[model samples]
Target: MSADPNPHPTEPDVRPHVYDGIREFNNRLPNWWLFTLYATIVFWVGYWAYYEWFRVEPEGARSVELAMTRIDAAKLAATAAVNIDDKSLWAMSRNPVFVDAGRQTFEANCVACHLKSLRGKSESPTAIGPDLTDQIWIHGGDPTDLYRTVTQGVPAKGMPTWGPVLGPKRITEAVAYVLSHHKEGEPIVIDTSVSAPAK
Candidate 1:
């Protein structure tokens, strides 16, 4: 026979002995999709190398330092600025300027926790701190005791250091306002039902 010059690319070289038509293809993958898959693999490898492998020690040290700093500040706020003398608080309360400052400070900070009435009642369910109106003082009721409590704070009870946060003059004002709870022109009144008599 003469050499077969025409060849059909679609037709397979081997013909099946029996007749049931099924075919196979040796198709190549699309170039764009294959490139995208390779790029994603490269990105994941680079990310793992930089963040997971390289900076572990430095990151750990930074976290530890932050934790220690927070603890120390809590300790200082709980313990500093305490003198434990009653007269000191009393003296501080007597000053009008100090009392006014105290009033302002109390309004700003304490009212949220202690209530505007200063009675320390019905506002907080558990009474996280103490009742200012009542005579029973935990740390002490005297002016000095009050000042110490106000400035240094009782961290165990979640009372923050107003002295550190605010300053001396503001602390004085807070004491004054607390002292004026029963008196006139105070920022908050325990019982507004009874009107104040003419000055």
Candidate 2:
């Protein structure tokens, strides 16, 4: 048989190994592709250094905590800005918006103890809280007194301090809702002789 033609090609780029009648060639990658690979590596290093090593920015939990703190501060500022008094509370009681918001808050939080009718012991003798609809006030009957009771709470009487829990706006709204059940000029008799309902 005659010698095989072109038994070994002289192309410098071709590798010595062959598989399935195919020869591998060592070619330079496109400039754009090389540039992209290098860019990605550089970007990864920078991102890791900035976020992990250097910690230039606050992490997720810390950022959320900061946001919550700012929100709380803003809420306090807003609460302070409002003129909260007997007259203002009475006015809020008359306002449909305030009353509605108060009702919602009361239903969510106060319904457990006070019951839905705003009459606790009156509605059911087994209720844990006293009647709010009655003219006789256990804590105090004035609008401001009611607001104070809600905010400060009566720990001795098993009431949770709602000021820090509900914030000022929500407490105000809830008090307004309670006040909506009574007339402004109605008689408010203070009866300290009445004991807190047994829980």
Listed in order, each prediction's TM-score against the native is 0.44, 0.61
**Tens-digit per-residue lDDT, 1-199, candidate 1:** 9885448766645534444665444445699989999999999887777667885444567878988999998777755653334555555567777677777778888987787777665456655445686554567555666778888987666679787788765676677678665332224323323123323
Clashing pairs in 1: 89-143, 89-144, 101-173, 102-173, 102-174
* lDDT of candidate model 1 versus the reference: 0.66
TM-score of 2: 0.61
In model 2, where do residues sit more than 4 Å from their true spots? 1-76, 195-199
Overall lDDT per candidate, in order of appearance: 0.66, 0.89
Query: For this target, which candidate reaches the highest lDDT against the unseen true structure?
Result: 2
lDDT for 138 (candidate 2): 83
For this target, which candidate reaches the highest TM-score against the unseen true structure? 2
- 1-199 in candidate 2: lDDT tens per residue? 9774554557457778999999988767899999999999999999888878999987789989999999999877998876689999999999999999999999999989999998998899999888999999988899888888989999888888998889888888999999999998998888877755544
Question: What's the distance in Å from true for residue 96, model 2?
Answer: 0.7
lDDT, model 2: 0.89
